[model samples]
Target: MKEKMLSFHDVKHIYHTVRGEVTATENLTFTVEKGEFVALIGPSGCGKSTLLSLAAGLLTPSEGEVSRRGSIGYMLQRDELFPWRTIEKNIRLPLEVQHRLDSESLERARTLAEKYGLGEFLQSYPSQLSGGMRQRAALIRTLAFDPDVLLLDEPFSALDYQTRLLVTQDVAKIIRSEGKTALLVTHDISEAISLASRVVVLTKRPARVAAEHELCFDGENDPLRRRENKQFSEWFELLWKELNA
Candidate 1:
């Protein structure tokens, strides 16, 4: 088994609002092993993002603990690529900000972009790229920092269905090839089942763990193949029932 990388111990998150305190996540507890791909799925407003925020260290838990032993790279629903920066510049931004940019790292970044089919667009600006390409750039930027844990919040939501599928396949291949640990917050049941080794389902607002499943399939971890698997729809329906229950 992989070593534990991120852990939430009875975590509780609350928001202060004009009306009063609002609980977002309550009594959540889980652990993600290093290099493990875990997915968070639930009904809308189920605190999936709130759980991700705590895991990313963007927010602190009001009670209990959310802890990570390594650096985190966050990819939001929006690509959020800077218009002023070229693809190369954007990918290098993380390293630059962390003061880790050097000739060797630049070379590594260039290689990553090239290997991922972004080489030809290295000098292109965000506006010059397609939505899919921009999302790739966003992911490249996240990877340039060499983060051990990637927190993805609906990274493909903005794309159309076809684009979303293609991007999901690409992103899954990229993450697996890089051997990075990922915790994704998504509402798509098929997506979670396809991309994750484990799925953690949560209850509606003031979320708690509702269910967890470990996926065991017979072939390459490709989204397309997973979708075609005989067990795929079964798992999806099961999750749907849990979410709607």
Candidate 2:
């Protein structure tokens, strides 16, 4: 059996605002196994982002437990690349922050940039790169530390439709190639379906697991190719109804 990398057992989170306490999730339970890709989707204001925050340890559950076996890397919606920093320096930020910027680690970061087609642009600033390239750089930065699991919070929502499609494919390919487990929170059902091996749907406010779908597509694992599958529309409609219902 695959070792579990992250698990949420009967988790609940309540935010204490001056207005009052607001529950975001209740009795949320799920497990992300080693190298698994799971996408989370739900209605607007359904606390989807909150789930990623909790998983990243940015917030603690008010009840139950959020357990993680290894380090987590978070990729936000915005690339969040420092405009003043070169792509190389941006990708190296994680190592520097962790105080692990040894020569070996720096070499590994450079190799990853090259391997992912950013070899020529390492010296380029974020402004010099396209949105997709910047997001790629952001991902490379996240991976520089070799985090065991990646928590993606709408990482592609900022891009144009075409760029979003292309970047999601690129991100999916890179994540799979590295054998990394990822938990993504996306409002786009199609995006979730294309990139995830499994989809977890949450209910409205005070979110809870409403449904789970295990996806299977023949042939290539590419997100673009997966979108063309007959089952893609089927799954999309199914999830659409689940979200609306």
**Predicted model with the maximum TM-score:** 2
Off by over 4 Å in 1: none
lDDT of 1 by residue, 62-162 (tens): 99998798899999998999899999999999999999888988888999999999999999999999999999989999998789999999999999999
Segments in model 2 whose C-alpha atoms lie over 4 Å from true places: none
Question: How much lDDT does each candidate structure score?
Answer: 0.92, 0.93
TM-score of each: 0.98, 0.98
lDDT tens digits by residue: candidate 2, 30-128: 999997899999998998888998999989899999999989999999999999999999999999999999999999999999999999999999999
Report residue 70 deviation for candidate 2 (angstroms).
0.8
Q: What is the lDDT of residue 38 in candidate 1?
A: 96
